[model samples]
Target: MKIAFYGSSLLSSYWNGAATYYRGILRELAGRGHDIVFYEPDAFDRQQHRDIDPPEWARVVVYDATPEALLRVMDEAADADVVVKASGVGVFDDELIEGVMQRAKPHALRIFWDVDAAATLDEMRSAPAHPIRRALPDLDMVLTYGGGQPVVDAYRGFGARECIPIYNALDPTTHHPVEPDPRFACDLAFLGNRLPDREARVEEFFLKAAALSPEKSFLIGGNGWDSKAMPANVRHRGHVYTAEHNAFNCSPLAVLNVARDSMAHIGFSPATRVFEAAGAAACLITDAWEGIELFLKPDEEVLVARDGQDVAAHLAALTPGRARSIGQAALARVRAEHSYALRGEQVDQILRDRSASITHRQQQMERA
Candidate 1:
C-alpha cells in the first residue's frame, strides 16, 4: 500500500511529542512492504532542530506553512492507497482534514489518526463544528495512539464510521538500553514539553516530589521551562534532543511519566515516553491513571503514584537492586508483548479487513 500521512514533524521531536510514535508505526508499516510518505510542516522552529536526517524507511516532505504548499502536498497525496490526516499538524489543520476527505482518489481509504484523542474529543463536545467532528462520518476509520475504549466510544458517539485505539509501543531498534551518561545523572528525571494542560500536573507530581525528597537529585528535560520555579535540588536541562533520550533515561535512577490532564482523566492513554523508557530498561514511575495494567504490570514492571507523596515515598524506599529488577522486568514485558512489530501487524490486519469489506460492499451494490 502507498500511505501518505500528514502529521507533525517526523524528523524533529523538538516541541512535537508524536514524532517517535509516527516513526515507530510508520517505520514498521514500511518494513512490511508498504510505501510511506510523511508530510510535515516547516513551522515552530522544528526544522531548525531536527534530531535525525530523513530516514530510509519513509520519504518525508517538509512543506512551508502556507496555503499554496498545502495544496501542492494534497495533489501529491491524491494517488495514495491510504490517506491520513493526523491531528495537531500545527498549521492549517482544518484545511488538511477537509483536503484528505475531498482531494484523495475516490477509492483511497481516509483516516484521521488522533495522537491526542482525549483533547480532540473534548474540543468536539464543546464545538460541534470542529473539523474532526464534521469529518468523522465520512472518514473510513479513526485511529488513536492512546485512549483505549473511552476514545473509541467517544468517536463513535461523534458519528465516526469506525474507531480503533492503537496504543504506543516500543520501537526496540530506535530506543533500547544504552550506557548511562554522567551529564544526565540524577535520582529521578522527568522529560516533557510544557503545555497548559500538563504544567500543573508536572508541578504537583514532579517538582513537589523533588521538594519532598530534598536529598535526591532531580533532572528536568524538555522545552518551555526556563522560568518555572522548581525546588533547589532539581536541575533543568531544557530541550533534550531525541538522540540523547536513551542516555537521559538510562542515567536516571528512575524515570517519570506524567500524563496530560486530559489523558489522565480519560485513562488508557500511555505516553510514548513510557515505552521508550521501558525499552531502555529504565525504572519507570508513572502518575496514577486507569488501564495501565493492560500494558505493564503494576508493582512489578512499573511503579504507580497517586500523588506527589506517593512519588516521594517510592523514591525514598527504592533500593538500587529493586529499581534494576523492575527495569529489567519492564524491558522483558514490552519486548515480548508491546513491540512496534506487533503493533504494525495489528494495524496491517485492520487495514486489510476494512479494504476487503469495502470491496464486498461495492460488489453487492453492483449486483443490485
Candidate 2:
C-alpha cells in the first residue's frame, strides 16, 4: 500500500519524542514492502537537524500545510491508498485536516494516528472549543501509540468508526545494548524534554530519587530543561541526538522513565524509551502505571517506582548481577513481543483482513 502521513515532525529526531516513534514504525513497515510518504511541514525544518539521513525505504515530502498547497497535492493524496493525520504534528492546522478529507480519493483510506491519545482526549474532554474535538468522527480510523484499552474506549465512545493501538516498539538491531561510555555511565538517568505537564512527575520520581541517593549520579537529557531547578546531584545534558540515544540508554546502571500525565492515567502506553532501553539490556526503574505488567514483569524484568523513595530503593538495593539479569530478561521479552517488526506485522495483518473483507463485499455486490 502507498501510505501518506501528516504529523508533527519527521526527517529529524531533534528533541522530538514522536520522531523516534515514527522512524521505528515507518521504517519497519517499509522493510516489510510497504511504501510510505511522510508529509511534514517546512516550518520546523527538521531535515536540517537530522542525525540520520531519511531512509531509502520511504520518501519525505515537505508541504506548506496551507489550503492552497494542499490543493496542489490533491491529486497525490487522491492517488495514495491511505492518508493519515497523526496527532501533535505541530502543523496540524484545522484547515489542513478538513482539506485532506475533502481531497481524499474514493479508495484512499484515512487514519488518525494519535500518538498522544490520552492527552488529546483530555484536552478535548475539558474544552469542547478545541478544533480537533469536532473532527474526530470524520476520521476513518483512530489509531493510538499508547493508551491500550482506556484510550481505545474513549476514542470509540467519541463515535470513531474504528480504534486501535499501534504502540511504541524497538528495532532490536538498531537499539540493542553496546558498551557504555564513561561520561554517560551514571547510576540512573531520565531522558525527556522539559514540558509543563511532565516536569512535576519528573520531580516527584527522578528529583526525589536523586535527593534520596546523594552519592548516586543522576543524568537528565533532552531539550527545554535549562530552567528546571534540578537537584545538585542531577546532571543535565540539554539534548542528545538520536544516534547517541542507545549509548545514553545503555550506559546507566538503570534508566529512569517518568510518564507524562496522559500516559499515567491512560495506562499501557509505555514510552518509546522503555522498549529501547529494554532492547539494550539496560535496567529500568519506571514510575508505576496500571498496565505495565503486560509488558514487563515487575520485580523481575522491570522495577516499578511510585515516588522518590521507590526509585531510590530500586537503585540503592538492586545488585549489579540482579540488574543485569533483569535487563537481559526485559530485553528478551521486548525482542519476542515489542519490536517494531512485531508492530509492522500486526498492522499488516489488520490491513490484510480489512482488504480481504472489502474485496469479498465488492464481489458479492457485483454478483447481486
Best by TM-score: 1
Q: What RMSD, rounded to one decimal, does every model reach?
A: 0.9, 2.0
Clashing pairs in 1: none
Give all candidates' CA lDDT scores: 0.93, 0.82
Which parts of model 2 have CA positions greater than 4 angstroms off?
64-75, 127-131, 359-368
lDDT for position 41 in model 2? 75
Candidate 1 ranges with C-alpha deviation above 4 Å: none
Instruction: Point to the candidate with the largest lDDT.
Output: 1
lDDT of 1 by residue, 250-272 (tens): 99999999999999999999999
